[model samples]
Target: MTGRLFGQGEVGSSDLIREAAKRAGAKLLEYELDAQFRCSGSDGFINWVDNTLDIRRTANVLWKREDVYEFRVMDSVQELEHAIRQKAAEGSARLVAGFCWPWSNPNGDGSLVKDVQVGTWAMPWNAKPDAGHLGAGIPKSNFWASDPGGLEQVGCVYTAQGFEFDYVGIIFGPDLRYDWEKNIWVGDKKHSFDSVVKKSGDRFVDLVKNTYRVLFTRGIKGCYVHFMDEGTRKFFQSRLE
Candidate 1:
């Protein structure tokens, strides 16, 4: 019974997952946060779970290069931005909102991306992420749980794997989308900075989708997504309709 039913990468699919988990009587879980924004769970804690732009385009600092793993810039997405902000700022729930993808390494000098943090450093960058963001495998850092409203830090399947949250907001990057003509999810290696995921060749799309799926299901109360690719967003919209 414990397996993945990862639906298509649609927009509200995470919401559906949350609903289904609730129906199943899944216990809601949250991270333990300290004043410094560091977060963790009580011993033996275990559960499975579940963006915006401008402020996002300006704030999302985690990247691989100028173009390789950059955030998709758009004209307007502040509502999505505000929802995340509201969850972190007002909701009593311990929330974490972030991006998902196959790449996001530290700058060349083993330093977190500066100027990206709206204020100070937090999750996604709090833990000393890998220096190059080029690890062949998924990142092993779990910093998202620690971030407050640090939009710059984005967590993928790698960081979100064994944890659950009260509410989770996700940024679905451009690495994966559907080919309307071909009728299959497509993984654009060009959009991926992780050499391993890019090198997956035939498995690239599956890996990407699964990565986002992990991100989507990392919340017990709710899940939200802001897709970077218009095509992917449209595909999701169609599915939701």
Candidate 2:
């Protein structure tokens, strides 16, 4: 089954597939997999996420299984990093962020530039695809989620997708923010680093929402997050309260 919640850039493949089948005069069958294998097998957690993100309304608005699956919001980027690192010692863990910063290439000395900066806190994005020779412990874009050294760098939606970790730390960037006055989520393309997604025009907001949905559900055991936007953070906190 395909999940539109995880769709990025343009429309998801399921839509295209359905359209093609209709045009070819072929009847298509679809099935819904209601069972939850991710987020500690808590279908409630998934529903909670959908409701929380304003993606759709679901029965599980507030998460009920705190003991079974962990979900936390951190005060700062530093706190998010520390929590993820601590979890990494016990099991697989990775830090991921929204496409809010430029992914810079390594220096001539094979040193990574800290492009993701929030206040005084800064960290480099995962190694570039052509990062021929990374410094001692850094992993290339593909292995960022699985490698031990991945903790040192921040990952974006591209590298973090299709991977599962025991725990995940996410930096909720300014690209997507909740408008308190209007009671809506606003997507600012100016704050987004993903040029391809920004080119999606009006669809950018939904894609950005889906990107976070993917990030939020990456952890099987737990997920921690740091929000750059205070109003947006408070909006999320209100849903739980």
Every model's Cα RMSD, please?
15.2, 7.0
Model 1, residue 6: what's the lDDT? 29
Provide the global lDDT of candidate 2 against the true structure. 0.86
Q: Write the per-residue lDDT of candidate 2 for residues 137-198, one digit (tens) a residue.
A: 88877778778888899888887887789999999999999998898899999999898998
Task: Please give each candidate's TM-score.
Answer: 0.52, 0.84
Top-scoring candidate (lDDT): 2
lDDT of each: 0.46, 0.86
Give every collision pair in model 1.
Answer: 49-217, 49-218, 49-219, 50-216, 50-217, 50-218, 50-219, 105-133
Look at candidate 2 and tell me the lDDT of residue 91.
92
**lDDT at position 132, candidate 1:** 38
Best by TM-score: 2
For residues 1-241, write the lDDT of model 1, one tens digit per residue: 1333322231344456678779999975544443211113311111111111111122222221232211222222344446656666654222222223224356554445432122232334333344434222323254335444334445445455655665566656667766778766767777666666777778776666666655655555455566666776766545331
